[model samples]
Target: MKHVLLATTGESPQVVTETLFALHQEHQPWPDALYLITTSRGQSKAREGLLERGHLARLCDELGVKQPLFDNSHILVVPDANGVPVDDARSLEDHEALANFIMTQVRNLTADPQQSVHASLAGGRKTMTFYLGYAMSLLGRQQDRLSHVLVSKGYESLADFWYPSQQQGQLHDRQGAPLLTAEGKPLIASAATVTLAPIPFVRHRQSLPAILPQTGESVHFRDVVRLINLGEQPEALRLQIDLAQQLITVSDEESDQRFEFKPSLIGLAFYAMMARATCAEESDLTRPSKKRADTALLKVFLDELMPLCGLQSCADWQTGLKQLLDWSELKGQVKDNTIDALNGGIPDYWFDQRKSELRKLFEQKLPLTVSRWLSPEIIWAEDGALLEQPGSTKGGGYGIPLARKNIEIINC
Candidate 1:
């Protein structure tokens, strides 16, 4: 199997040699090839310090190690959207291109079953290192590795420094001042310390759906990481709606655990309706209904609320429920109609205000974390109106995105 060293670098190309020396001391397998990701300025410095100055070749010769296959072609400069080599990643576009480039390289390397990649993030800007590390986590295989090289203080960022030489040699700082050890002795290149710290990561490519490169869409780093984390959790959540108790029970089937939320009558009605819609695979939950409530849908909402509101056994409950269910009657209340008058006459507007109130009540009743997790799955709105139809809609809405198999609706 071929071993590959994939690294990112900025102005400091010595990181490569330092990393190689540390790996050698640890008796790790040496790479047969070296690939570097950098910027235009970084490319120039690397070529000058490693190739032109013969530091790389000298290190291999002195260490009695075979030189890896690294040359001008092995250096990849991050490019802008216009295909121009980026001088530095200072702009948003440059950063995006850098991410894409790192992801592409990681994907390409992982595609080959015969190769194992060793990624080093010790060299390069913080953003560059972050992108490289994240990309590797996304696509790395079991055999792949990630690491950061640590050089002893005195030798860090020294221009003439490459690795600990076989013979003792004086080290100088960037400004040509002699670097000294803590004992006040001249720093010797041969005695410089280097350590390779391996980074632990969760490789999620196998767990996630295969994302083809040809799609021309780059995956957001955060999204990839979030999905990986979610996969590591116990299991997907299952929801149970109890209309009688005006409660929503969220359970993790794998852990046999549950969380309950008690919402107000209006909130419970809205939530139960959404839960039922999700269970039935209804997608039209975001569509604006005609100004008047659909009688059947109105009944579904009322049925959920009546039990919770203690109106089920009242002699005038039906009359009160009808007035409460009327969107015009509800809307008229916001226009200064007394609560008593709202129970008798209808008006002209929709019942969006009620939906908003329900949303706030439902969210406020749950723990912030649970509310965030459940919000997208159970909320829907269109043209300021709550949607409760049995079909899917393309417009914005809130409701659980779960299938009927995951939801259970009980009368009590």
Candidate 2:
């Protein structure tokens, strides 16, 4: 597996080498790659200290360890919209740009399942540190880790101290005097102690909303934060598939009001799965297959509707629920009415059409956040949106991720 060390650095680029030494002392594998995020002046400082001065190489050579991949590209400098690097983060725009840049990189890195990050939160601006740490908490998995390098007091402020060396080396104090130990011996680089402090962080991926935009799109840090803080969904809303009334009803417990609106037959049929799964806590929700209609496929949809329809008394019904109640003949009649439209016993176009129709209807009628959650487009894997089994097209089939206590399927 590829192990990467991601760190934010400022003028104190020694944080990288110190972090490396700390990891080495803890018996951690040398990272396969190393990345430093910083601003223009910080970039110059890192280039001079670690690259030009050969401090990074010297540390590795003195420690007898191979160096992780490091070069100019590894030092990522935050830049402006015009691609020009800035000296420091003095403006709000610079910090915003810095956040997006850092989070974007972290997102791309953690998206790879084979990679594990050892994020060193030991450097960079206070905002940069916060952004990187937050990014790790949001996107990091179990295998990934977060750490900070803690240098003992004597070495913490020493500009020349990167890591302890095997051989003794001369060093000056802040006063430009020959630094000496308690015994008046010359201060040595090898005498300093660096410790890697592990930071406990919560992984919030499990708590993200089910309606996140489809995967693979670039997600901004602020947008993600906004979604996470979108607050709680209105819980006690009953979604009634009133077959008798030929309309759907949303009951808001807090307001004690009922919202009634009729959807097309196809829309009603598709929503039955979403409403049932959300209210019943069904674990096997899935999207229809793109193939010819079959009894088995039709059964999947019927299974949800049958219980709500109470088919035995459908003789008194005035809606199409009666024909839909007869599961055996339902597939043939549906395929015959909509010839060449069956895909997994469902019309091929109905999936997209019904979702769009439902969205518009609920948006126009209900005018609440519940409308969106009830008919979300994307079925997130960890969002409890669907079962990723042999027949489930995970995202192809949608499920409502609302709490069962918040949802009740009233069959009218």
Candidate 3:
């Protein structure tokens, strides 16, 4: 009789799917019982407690992998005083306990004196993988067994595997054909050097060496990276400005007019409302500055605007703005009269208050301005003279104006 044990942490669905495929391939020749060992962290979740463990469990069940409902008979999931599971115990101790539990369970399965055990380490975090492998080592199979599956070039999608640095900046086809040279190959390939990082496999006592390699002489177009984060680099600001200048040079204003003046009106409205609300609370405009207003705008946009616009799923601003606005509240405000309560004209105060409130909302809700490769420098002044604006710079804060389009400063 053969017992095949597959250990995993179940952190990602991709891991589970890949492991299942590999298990089915390996177990094709013989009749085998399956054992799934998952750490506490491997449990899959759906939307933060709405339905936590069901998603991954169902996935496993669909693949015909079987396991008991609980980890073992001795331990149960009991709630604390706050009704939360305090599962943070000794990691190594938990591994030993689990190993003992598995050994006990397998003992009751068959009466055959010559039983062979096969263990596969395919998924889970590094620590979990190491612990499971350690347990399996102690169990010690008496047959042909191996800890890791050796992958070549095509198996890039494997859980923790990575290509060597010597292969970096090189594009390979599915059949492992070189697509481009790593160094500068203008049209089809640009010869360039790319650094690859080493992957640590503590369980198997194996590590890959770092390599930086040059590719061949062709740019297969498929080798290009579509998305990259420039992060907080000043070079990002220059890149965007360069791109904009290039666009302006190649395309006439008449041809690209459609893309030019579509200022973020909803973004503007959000900032306006925040600034207005905070300014009304205190007679001083300094009380609700642009930075503060931007922060507030971000909060409302994330918590309220995205949900109301039915764009919560995507969290994209373009989709949010395209949704229809009822404008019912604006109409109601227009009809109401609260002029005598304020010495300043109510209409004027209302407009100013609304603008400031929107500004405050954006200041609060929007992410802090940072340099990105696509960020434009048309708005920011170089000498720091334009840094100071309308509001108070009292508390280690820089002033930003609510009405200006170029308030973003990418100093990085």
Candidate 4:
């Protein structure tokens, strides 16, 4: 199997050798090939420090290790929208391009079944390190790894420092001044300390859908990481719908936190109906459908909502049901003459509008952070939706994607 070391670098190219040294000390498998993602300036610095000065070859020779396949060709310079190599990732456009370039490289490398990648985020700008780590999390295989090399404070950022040599070697400062030990002797590379800390991440490459590049469409690296993190979150949360109090409570067993939401009666009813549908094994109920609302279904929903609405009498429930059923008639669009069509029927447009209103109400009542995690469980998209697939159907509807065991209906 081919082992590959993937790293991101900025002006300082010593991270490559530092990481290599740490891995060797830890008795980890050394990479057979090295690939560096950087900007134009970074590429030049790497060439000067590692290749032009023979630091890379010297480190390998001093350590008595086989040199990996790395050269100018292995250095990937991030390009801008115009295909011109970017000098630095200081602008948002540069960062986006850099992210895309990193993702593409990770995807291509992980495509080979026999390849194992070791990603080092010890170099480059902060954004570069972030993007590389995120890309690895997205596409990394079980055999793949992520790490950041840590060098002792004094040895870090030193111009002449590469790897800790076995024999005594001269170490110089940025201005070429000899760095001395406490005894006044010239410091050697062996005095430097290096450690490689492996990073743990949840890989969702297989779970993510194929993201084909579209002309006007783009995927943000952060958005992808957020989604993968959400998917990997343990299903330890449950929602308790207290219809009598017109409140929804989200309980997270893992965090031992509880969030409460007080929505309008209509919003609460709508949410309850969706929750009921999801629990009853009705798939795709969380999605909005163009199909008109069935009168029978509407009647069942109203019946279920009456007790929650605090209707004291049958007459009150009947009046509320009549008001909803008469919406189409009031709009002067009476298509069907049957009692079911007149009393319980609802237009698809009207249903969708009501759902949108309910969603807005719920969102307004819930905390922003909590709402993000709960929106998919509450709001149903009309089109182009990407959410958890607990179940599916040809016709869309509104429902949560949670297991029935996690939902509880209290106080009727």
Whole-model lDDT values for every prediction: 0.69, 0.68, 0.31, 0.70
Scanning candidate 2 in windows of ten residues, the lowest lDDT window is 313-322
Best by lDDT: 4
Q: Give the Å shift of residue 66 in candidate 3.
A: 12
lDDT, candidate 3, 46-79, per-residue tens: 1121124343344345445653233332122222
- Candidate 2, 307-386: lDDT as tens digits: 44444423222233345534436544233343234333554455556668887777653323456555645443445545
Looking at model 4, report the run of 10 residues with the lowest lDDT sum: 209-218
TM-score of 2: 0.62
Top-TM-score structure, candidate number: 2
Models 1 onward score TM values of 0.55, 0.62, 0.26, 0.55
Local distance difference test, candidate 4: 0.70
- Candidate 3: stretches off by over 4 Å: 23-31, 45-114, 149-412
Q: What is the C-alpha RMSD of each candidate to the true structure, in Å?
A: 17.3, 11.3, 24.6, 14.0
Clashes of each: 14, 1, 61, 4
Clashing pairs in model 2, backbone N/Cα/C closer than 3 A: 287-397
Over 1-412, each residue of candidate 4 has an lDDT whose tens digit, in order, gives 9999999999999999899988888999889999999989999999998899888888788778999999999999988865589887667776777787777788777777788999999998888888888788777889999999998867778777888877647887878888987778878888788999999999766555344112234445544544344334536657898876778887666554555777655556657777777566554443324564555555555665556634432344346565544553654332224224325355555556556665455345333333434443532334524335522433445566555677887757
**Candidate 1, residues 329-386: lDDT per residue as tens digits?**
5554222342232342222222355455544543443323333345434234445344
Determine the backbone clash count of candidate 3: 61
Best-first order by TM-score: 2, 1, 4, 3
